[model samples]
Each structure stands twice: as structure tokens, then as C-alpha cells.
Target: MANGLTVKQQRFVDFYIETGNATGAARKAGYKKPNPQGSENLAKPSIKAAIDARLKEIEDARVADAREVMIFLTSALRGELKEEVVVVEGEGEGVSSARTLQKQIGAHDRLDAAKQLAKRYGLDGDGELLKLQKEKLKAEVNEMKTAPSDALHINFTFDRRPKDGH
Candidate 1:
């Protein structure tokens, strides 16, 4: 046993992290009764700590930190990311030799990424610009609501008449 945990316990921790299923991990670890031992093992301090540490290690390796996120956002804003697009140079031909060319990402996507980066990095004029823009839009909407409708209005008044025309 390593670190005071049995071999099966270590295996269980490994499988648990991989499968994310306690009972399945226990079964894979060769536990006789996985149903009960699966959850019970997690309650053990050593196993829990080992699992937590391993998970942290995996996250540290697989997950990106704030700096990485910022870098990615910057790259997206700069349109450095590319997408595969099929361009047909010769129309009316069934299969034309088309070459994929690297082009800047669409303005819409780049603008979206830029907006997020701006908000995240305090580049939106300390939120004051956004707030003012929002206020301006709201005022425009209010003005539109109060503006006279150009829709044509028609009213018809009919006098009540008896069936006998009396």
C-alpha cells in the first residue's frame, strides 16, 4: 500500500477520476462489493485527499488560467483564428479546384470578442462608456415609443337598424 492506502484504494481513486462514477470505479478497482464500498471509500480522508490532489493536478494541466484566457481573447479580437471555407472560383462546374485561404474572421465575431476583452480588461472607459451608450439607447427607445404612429387609423360608426327596417 502506498501512502497508507491499499492498492485497490489507489486504483479506485484513479478510476474514479477517470470515470467519474464511484461504483464503477470500485468495481474496476476489484472491490468485492462496489455498491457500498464505492461511496464509502470516498468518505475516507486519505482517499479523498488523494482524489482531490489528483483532480487539482489534472485541472492545472488541462485548464487555462486568466492569462491564457486573456491571450485567447486577444487573439480572437485580432482575428488570428481561422476557419475553413470553401470558395468556388468557377461557377457552373460540379467540382472545381478550390483552395482554402486564410482570412480574417468576420467582423461580428471579432467585435464580440473585442467587446468581451474590453469589458474584462477595463478598456471600456471604466464602464462609463457602456453605461452612457445604454442610457442613450434607452432614451432613443423611449422617444420612439412616444413618437406619433404613421399607421393609418380608420373608424366606422353604424346606426342601429331593426330587421324590418323600422
Candidate 2:
């Protein structure tokens, strides 16, 4: 009914949105036999438009802007978020005190998140992060090219001793 789609087409859209799999959505929407053309059905212009509109609506409803993502990463980097912990009680009287352990989000993860945020904000350079990286790599290559040739030269020799029997 919506977007000029038939009831089945609308159901297909709903299923596709919920399951995020075209073939599965087709099967769930009452396609009894093998539908090798299921993806092709989804590719129809009307169906595609309906799906895109639904996705846009969903994305708009769940609003997490780049600023929010950056703030969360900053908070994580600052250790402002509480770490999860688990406690286990021992069964025996002689057992040690109950053990407690905090969950760990590795430093590498935090650093990588921070780096992604930095790249998104263009803090690293004019272009995107990959472009900046390419530029940096080019600069390093140029530096290596211009460096003294003597630095590249290495002289070494191996000394072989005569055999004991000889």
C-alpha cells in the first residue's frame, strides 16, 4: 500500500528491513519454491526505492552524530566509563577470598577508535585518513630516495676455517 507497492511487496520490504537479507526476506514473505531470482525481485526500481526510504527513516530515527561518537571515544580514552567486573565465590572454607576481575577493553582498540575519529574530523590532513597516510608514505619514500647512498651500502665477509682433518 505504501509507495505504490503491493501487499506482498510491502511485506517483502518489511521482512528485508527486519532481516537485512534479501533472499531470506523473500522466503519469509511466502515464496514457497526456490527463488533464485529473489535478489532480482529486490532490485526492482519500486522495491528498491521503498527499501531505501525505509532505511533512511530508520537511520534518521536513530540519531548518533559524529560529535556524539567523538565524545564517547574521548570519554573511553579518558577512562571515564566504568569497566565491567565479575566476582566468583569459592565453595570451601579454606578457599581464598572471593575473586573479582574487571573486564578490559584493550588500549589498541581505544587508540584505533581515536584515530578513526581524528580522520573523520580531518584533523590529520586535508584529505581523508587514507590519503594522509599515502602522503606520509610518499614523503618517507622521497626522504629515503634523497638520503646518502653510503648509508645504503653494507660490506661484510664470512671467514671460513680449514677443516680439522685437512
Candidate 3:
């Protein structure tokens, strides 16, 4: 409404969030058929801003914020959580014992979680890693392009006879 979106435009926002696809959302919103540029139209500044506002509203209602995510990941990585198990013995004279088993997060799991946190906080050198990977891939592509065709060809002859003297 603030963006002056029409009824159909508002419906498009709802469908977009539901489908996570702009073209499909436009179709579901009862927009014109065969609208190949539906996504492009949605990319317009006003439309994009409306969508962003709607998404923020939905996220604020349903999703956890960054701090909550960090706390959860930190707890998981630290293995501070425990699993409760109840053991029962005998049916009539049942004896129940409740036990809490500490969940041990493996080194790999902790490393992965830490890496994710680092990435979220921009502490990981992801840009450098990406640059290195890009350079490596470019080098490989150049090598392939400059490689001699004969280098890829192999000739083999097999003398299957016992070794000249059985």
C-alpha cells in the first residue's frame, strides 16, 4: 500500500513468498498469461522494495535473528546440549531411571560450525579463498587451451605372447 502496489501486486508478494519464484508468483497472482518478463518487472525498484518490506515482516514474525542463530550454533558446537533417556525395568514393578547423556560434537562438526560463524561475521578469508580458486581454475583452463593435442593421445601395443619363451 505504501508503495502504491495494486491488489494484484500485493497478491504477487504473497505468492512470491510462498513459491520463492517471481515468475511463478506472477502466474499464481493472476497476472497476464505468458509473461516471460515477470521476474524482470518484479525487479523494478518500487516492486523490489515492497517485496523486501513484506519479506522483512514475515521474517520478523517467523524467523530467528542473527544473534539467536549464533547462540544456537555456539551451543551446538560446544556440545553443551544433552539428550535425556528413560530406562524402564519390569512391567508391573517397573523401575524407571532417567539419564542425561551429553551430546559430544565431533571436531569436524565444531570446525564446520566455527567456519560458518566466521563466514557470518566476515572473519573467514572467503574472498581470498575465492580468489585463489578462481586463479587456479583460470590456470587450468589456460593449460587446457594451450595443451598439445598429441599430449592427450596415447598409443599402445600389447604383445600377448608369453614373453618370447613361456
Find the number of clashing residue pairs for candidate 2: 0
lDDT of 3: 0.77
User: Alpha-carbon error at 5 in model 1, in Å?
Assistant: 3.0
- Pairs in steric clash, model 3: none
Candidate 2 lDDT over residue span 1-166, tens digit each: 5479887778888998998888888888876642664687677999999999999999977988777888888877665655666676777886755565765556876777677777776776554667878999999788878989876654798758666744
Highest lDDT: which candidate? Answer: 1
Clash number by candidate, in order? 0, 0, 0
Which ten-residue region of model 1 has the weakest summed lDDT? 88-97
Residue 113 error, candidate 1, Å: 3.1
* TM-score-sorted candidate list, best first: 1, 2, 3
Predicted candidate 1 versus true structure: per-residue lDDT over 1-166, tens digit per residue: 6577899999999999999999999999999999999999999999999999999999999999999988988898888988777775865657566877767789898898898898896677768788888899999788777878874354798979987898
Each prediction's TM-score versus the true structure: 0.58, 0.42, 0.40
Give the least accurate 10-residue stretch of model 3, judged by summed lDDT. 82-91
Q: What local lDDT does model 2 show for residue 150?
A: 75
**lDDT values of the candidates?**
0.88, 0.77, 0.77
lDDT of 2: 0.77
Q: Which pairs in model 2 have colliding backbones? A: none
